[model samples]
Target: MFAPMDSTEIFWVATICVLLAVELATLGLTTIWFVGGALIALAAYECGAGMPLQLILFTCV
Candidate 1:
């Protein structure tokens, strides 16, 4: 599990950044969809989602 880096906003942002980087690198819309998912988790995290729920929200986008 990830430790120390406990802030969900940071995690979501980092994930979106990486996703965007991947999208930009390959210009693949696949990563763009995942970026959307990360945004959803960001919103849910703002609403106080737990890690499990946040992960699920990320997966569902």
Candidate 2:
């Protein structure tokens, strides 16, 4: 089994998945940016970033 993920990790992962799905479905290159942001945010979270920092990374990445 996989290690348990915290809510923050789950949220970022879910966001990435949903955005990826939307990008795949549309192929319009819209949600792709958000997907990158989500990925960065997830990385930041894994690096022990705080919620505010994670949100900032998600928005400004």
Candidate 3:
């Protein structure tokens, strides 16, 4: 059986997607760092991090 994805992971993935879309549209570096942060948070979530810890990891990145 497969475990369902957590909301936090979904949110992080969504954020990363949106940021990437914006980056693509603008062709600018702005928001790319945020995408990096979101990717890091997504990784944290995949590693079984809690929401609070994920947020902290995102902020740090």
Candidate 4:
């Protein structure tokens, strides 16, 4: 099955969600930022942005 949105965005968001859930379930600080970063990348991709911009956004957030 395929996502309704761009493939890159779908995968990244799914990965983000998975990471976030795991982080929450485990109560660990680790890996949450990476998941957030992926979410940032996914949003950037959907917005027609580039990797550099997404990285910047993720780092700043």
lDDT of 2 by residue, 1-61 (tens): 8899988898999999999999999999998999999999899889988989988988986
Best-fitting candidate, scored by lDDT: 2
Candidate order, TM-score descending: 2, 1, 3, 4
What ranking emerges by lDDT with the best candidate at the front? 2, 3, 1, 4
Candidate 3: where are CA atoms >4 Å away?
A: 1-3
Whichever of 3 and 4 has more TM-score, that candidate is: 3
Model 1 over residues 1-61: C-alpha lDDT tens digits?
8555456688889999999999999986788989998998888877877889978977886
lDDT scores for all predictions?
0.85, 0.92, 0.87, 0.79
1 versus 4: better lDDT goes to: 1
| Model 1 backbone overlap count | 0
RMSD to truth, every model:
5.2, 1.2, 1.7, 3.4
Predicted structure 1, TM vs. truth: 0.81
lDDT of 4 by residue, 4-54 (tens): 776667677788888888999988788788887887777788889987787
| Residue-level lDDT tens digits of model 3 in 1-56 | 98887677678889999999999999889889889989988988888888898888
Better of 2 and 3 by TM-score: 2
The candidate 2 region of ten consecutive residues with least summed lDDT is 52-61
TM-score for each candidate, following the candidate numbering: 0.81, 0.91, 0.81, 0.63
Clashing pairs in 1: none
- Whole-model alpha-carbon lDDT for candidate 4: 0.79
Tell me the spans in candidate 2 whose CA falls farther than 4 Å from its real position.
none
Query: Clash number for every model?
Result: 0, 0, 0, 0
